[model samples]
Target: MSKRNQKNRQKQKVNYIGGRKSFVRILEEMNEQDPNLIRFYKEVHWSRKKGCFITDTAEHNYKLMLERLDETEVNTENNNEKCNAAFKEVLGHRSGYAKELGHSVIPEPSIALHKNRDYLRIVEENERNKN
Candidate 1:
């Protein structure tokens, strides 16, 4: 096969943890194993026209999910590793958006900063302008 064909084949391979069924299965396992441990799982949707990610929370929870996945066993197969890869991709996209808005890094502001509604508004406005 040609190099291009080989690359296409690689892309066509099903990602074990990228699918919703497997992702939720792993999350449920984690939750059942330990209810005390906080695990935030949300379906992340991206809007091409809006040029941003949309979720229930106005905040990106990719980093937190990644951190928890690193500590916990997400699946029986090698799916845990693939899940991490998927979340990392989301984090990369989010970081790109942050950079475009002139932020040095993705804002994980302190509690005090989060409480400052004016500051958040300004930051959000900057993101919209950049988009």
Candidate 2:
């Protein structure tokens, strides 16, 4: 119950919170090894509550890592194309990208009506023709 541990637990918002440390171990491993750029192995335990292969925290952290990798790939100026490519390939794999709900997470649609105006227009036109 040290301050650092408490902070990480809060920051990670670990999903398998019912007396399990598996998700925390995975996060530590990722932080220590930076395995996103290389092949790595870690055993994942199922959460009885989630009924999935991984916890929500694990999935969320994986997404954060992917974003960091993308930023590194774009910002680095040392001709590190191969390094960046390796990281991207690992992220594309199921182990790195799998989610509790599914393999791919679809982004929510934009809220602005103007952005979806074309689709709305087509629907309205069809409605007019139907009458």
Clashes of each: 0, 0
Alpha-carbon shift of residue 116 in model 1 (angstroms): 60
Cα lDDT of model 1 by residue, 1-131, tens digit: 69998888676422222345444445556656642112323332334456654543322454555564666666657554556455554443454454433212455668899779999999899999999
Each model's lDDT: 0.50, 0.49
Task: Give the TM-scores of the predictions, in the order they appear.
Answer: 0.22, 0.24
Please, what are the lDDT tens digits per residue for candidate 2 over residues 48-131?
455653656555545554555555645445424444454455445454433432223444445785468797898689999999
Q: Clashes in model 1: which pairs?
A: none
Number of the predicted model whose TM-score against the real structure is largest: 2
Instruction: Give the Å shift of residue 93 in candidate 2.
Output: 25
Residue-pair clashes, model 1: 0
Off by over 4 Å in 2: 1-53, 74-131
What overall lDDT, based on C-alpha atoms, would model 2 receive against the true structure?
A: 0.49
Model 2, TM vs. native: 0.24
Model 2, 61: alpha-carbon shift in Å? Answer: 0.7
